[model samples]
Target: MQKKMIKKIRKRDTKGLDYVINNYSKKVYYLVDKIIGFYGREEVEECVSDVFYELWENIDQFDEKRGEFSSFIYMKTKYKALDYKRRLEKKEVHKTELEDDITNKITTEHIVLDKESSEEIIEIINNFKEPDKTYFYNRYFMYYKVDDIAVMYKTTRASVENRLYRCRLKIKEMLEGRK
Candidate 1:
């Protein structure tokens, strides 16, 4: 049934896709607004729109057996919103050097492959231990970025970068071993 739905979507089944978009767009908008706020409303709105485009483009990748599609969409929108927020916060820094510092600090070193690989990557992220895992989720998963994570958790951007580095390396190693 899920496969058939995915096939229908991939076949340019506008009605099927519309069913998804209509069912999910409100939730996406609410989450985006809640997380990104109006201070930088344009960026948030743009990112929310991007998330929907991504959802439509990648709809066939979804696997209902693993989890509910709505949860996946929620998480993706949340991350995109966070990324928007992170970019806006960095814009507040003003200095070119500071912007560079922020960019390097929160960079995501991971590459998402096909659905199976993405699922594996998510599983590895889920395996992280407290504080480190939560911090990581807040940073990358939420798109908090390094500087924002530092401010939110009362730490330094350098420290957050180090955490991200370690987390990335750890996940990389885990994924490599799984291959």
Candidate 2:
């Protein structure tokens, strides 16, 4: 059955994917729910969608010689669900400097300011060149995941994070100088 589904999937047959989804979605949902269930049904559903998409996109990397197809599905679903859970937790989890500073200041002091100050900060970030401008706006304003931002810039996650950190420090310094 796995061989048949694999062949159909490899051929880009939607029916093959549908078959896999029909067979595997419940199990995927069960696993994802067990991990990220507290976030509610919407998260569980999205994780299931992502798991299937990943399997379809990365089917070539799956080696039967390495493991069972069921195991592959299980592991993929598990990790994807965990990632979703982590993202959800991070959104509401803690109050770190990155979350506070350059967000909506520097170090322990949040540069509380009026509307003008906010505009000034926006202008400061906009003046940055190329990727820095893009990175800062996305990271600070759009709340994009660093990993997703890295993919957009064709760079590593560490690199994106490093750039964002530097941008934050620069902004912090600039804001301080204004005081």
Candidate 3:
């Protein structure tokens, strides 16, 4: 049934498409909100709709056995939110400061993982909830410094640093276990 639905959607069968959309719309919206947070209710709605359009556009590329459907949708929303964040950064008038920050972070902290290792790192990080995952991504992938992460997370720099240090150690352990 799942394969048939996917096939129908790929063939442009409207009814099958509608069935999938109707079933998955709320899940997609919740997933997007989880990734991007509540900017505003309307923006949240649009982001979810954007995810669906992306999913529909690329539905044929989905591989069922590789991941859960929810995970696939979550990843799609996550990438979209990251792209939106980059767009906002590009629009900033304070580009020099941003560039300087990027330079400083790159010169300071190291990215410990290669491509395959990074995926394993993500799997470990996904085990965290709420502010933990948010904090980890902001600190590492987005390269926000401890002070910046503290401001965003409304915590002290020491606390943010501790969480990041532990999260990194946890990810390293998880990757080691995979060996």
Off by over 4 Å in 3: 89-179
lDDT of 3 by residue, 117-160 (tens): 55656677889876779888887688677678888768897787
By lDDT, the best candidate is: 2
Tens digits of per-residue lDDT, candidate 2, 130-177, equal 799998778766878777899998999889878877876777778878
Q: How do the residues 24-123 of candidate 1 rate in per-residue lDDT, one tens digit apiece?
A: 7888888998987765678667887899778778886777888987787898898888888887777776566466645544444434442355777778
Task: State candidate 2's TM-score.
Answer: 0.53
Question: Comparing 1 and 2 by lDDT, which wins?
Answer: 2
What range of 10 consecutive residues in model 3 has the weakest lDDT sum? Answer: 107-116
Sort the predicted structures by TM-score, highest score first. Answer: 2, 1, 3
Query: Could you tell me the lDDT of residue 178 within candidate 3?
Result: 66
What lDDT is reached at residue 124 by model 3? 73
- Candidate 2: clashing pairs of residues: 102-105
Candidate 2 wrong stretches, greater than 4 Å: 94-179
What would the TM-score be for candidate 3 when compared with the true structure? Answer: 0.46
lDDT-wise, the better of 1 and 3 is 1
Model 1 stretches astray by more than 4 angstroms: 1-5, 95-179
